[model samples]
Target chain A: MRRAVSALLALLIFAYLFGVLLKAPIPGDYRDERYNYYSPLSGREANESVPDHYVERGEEETGSQNIVTSIVVLYRGFDTLGEVTVLFTAATGVAFLLSTQRSKGEKEKKKEPNFMASTGVGLVLPFILLVGAYIFVHGHLTPGGGFPGGAVIATGFVLMLVAYPRFQLREKKVSVVEAFSGLAFAVIGLISLIMGLTFLENYLPKGVAGTLLSAGIIPLIYIAIGFKVGSELSAIVSHMKGGEE
Target chain B: MMANLPFIMVALFIAIGLYAVLFKTNLIKIVMGISIIESAVNLFLIAGGYVKGGIAPIYTSAPEGEEMVLPTPQALTLTAIVIGLATTALLLSFVVLIYRHYGSIDSRKIRGLRE
Candidate 1:
């Protein structure tokens, strides 16, 4: 049977992975304070890995207190931009696919949600939005960032959609939010380029490291990302739900 | 074997997902399997970057003399998670369309009718 063959194949793959990955060295054994990285450029054993440098010096170099934030928004910002583009493409595809199925969406007799659940969504949405905003705003100093913050805000919208089957997200407003936030990210990058720096390079002064105002363009980029992601996700949800525009 | 517990779990998760993808008949289940595979990959990346007793890579009010975990992997994982979300959404939309046209989500039925 196909199922039997696939199970055997999966088992074989698991065995191969177990053999290879289990033999690899354990990370962070605490026996070594210093990291050992083999650098191909110099063909030498270096005492510090790339991560070690990021941890030790990232704050001073990027003016961001969070090393992860520095890596995501500064060092690998081009990748983040690509990821956002991917999200946007997916959102557009979903909308395009579902937009043609208008007749079915209107015919289903949707049951009205109960009072408690509907009322609770109205009460809880603001706190969710506030937490999402806080997460992206303090991304340079906290564990949360643009993606999670945006997801949280989208969660609020999802809650609303689930509670009220008839609840509609204005498609125009959603697209405008998506467009402007996306433009904000690109505009910041263009500003950096016009200022005689590389694309997306920080143009503003790196303030004191621990403060909310620090990290130069890092927080700004994250804030932009938060808005962009939030709107795109909510738009996708609205499209999928077949809510009236 | 025990020292590699996290890696083993990651591999097992991936294997289970692979099995689902290969063996399942339902389109929706296949999408779930793909999402599971993404989660496993994210787990693998995080496990690879583990530093024992390491705190997050943030420097704001960080404890004195504590080691920080690798930042690059976590950043990469964040990217992966978002991409996974997008892919999952896209996949689900496709599944919905399939169901809409065919009135069923079973692969066997859909495959036979494909011209």
Candidate 2:
């Protein structure tokens, strides 16, 4: 009965979504006339062309050739900072929830996981860590970013705990990494302020746009983000896996 | 037909994932459904940034100019992937905790945590 109800609900939801999809205007075919009824300024030509100067300067000022990176790190640095903080808060919350000492009965009594799983995870661990670090490091230059890279690196800790149930992470050591990375992140932002720019502003030279070392604080900030994310994730994993057997 | 293949597949995968999430009774399966959705979205995001046969967004030489694939979507997808991992891990941990408490991995039995 529950399955039937759920299936019916799912069907209804999909049908509604399909209806909305059919009614929605396609991106390329977007027209002012379609949205005319919703406009506050009733008869105003309704379609206003945006200025190209900001767009053009954004292409040049941010240093990174990729327009998205330019906008993310330079044009909208504060939003990115907030996003990082959200991740940090989530990690903290997970750690807080999972942080608990093992009871007397559960202490030091570790059950061995399957040998195949252990060996498989062990073999894959380095590659995972490598990819994570690679993603973090190349964030500014490529498609990857600090958050993803950091999470990737932290998976190493999680995998270790899974493969070797006996492995316990010391919260103290992980906390140090977390704290230092966060501090470094704040310091980078402060440096921008000290240089007489707004908070998290790109005070350093916007190097020749498409090169590896081109975006000054862009790379630096991503590195800091990577460190922060890695440590935070590892800490969360440790907290979750550290307790009990 | 070939150009639209990836998008179609991704959309289908996402639909399947959404279907599984709503209908699956097992906690683990629901989590897998969520992961599948994440994967599908990642594929879509990556596909959105694709410039037909373009090189990596980096440039060893400047003369090649600026007609490259948008790196933003890829970066966004990468971030999304990380966030997805964190979410999935947290969800799995919750599932484990829920199982430990209820002695069952069934979602219907775990409704006690809802209120």
Return the top candidate by DockQ: 1
In model 1, how large is the Cα lDDT of residue A4? 95
lDDT of 1 by residue, A158-229 (tens): 998888877789988989989999989989889988989998888888998789998999999999999999
Cα DockQ of the candidate 1 complex: 0.78
Candidate 2 structure quality by residue, lDDT tens digits, B41-69: 89877775565555555433433544445
What is candidate 1's CA lDDT for residue A203?
80
lDDT of 1 by residue, B1-115 (tens): 6878988988898899999999999999999889988999999899888898999888888899998888899999999999999999999989888888787899988876653
Residue-level lDDT of model 2, residues A1-245, one tens digit each, is: 76677667656655664555445443223322333233355444433222122233445666765555655666667767766777777776676555542334434557888799799998999999899987866665666667778878888888888788778777777778778877887888888888888888787787776666777788888788888888888877776665533
Instruction: For candidate 1, give the lDDT of residue A221.
Output: 95
lDDT for position B61 in model 2? 48
The deviation in Å at residue A235 for candidate 1 is: 0.9
TM-score of chain B of each: 0.94, 0.85
Evaluated against the true structure, the overall lDDT of model 1 is 0.88
- Native contact fraction, candidates in order: 0.87, 0.13
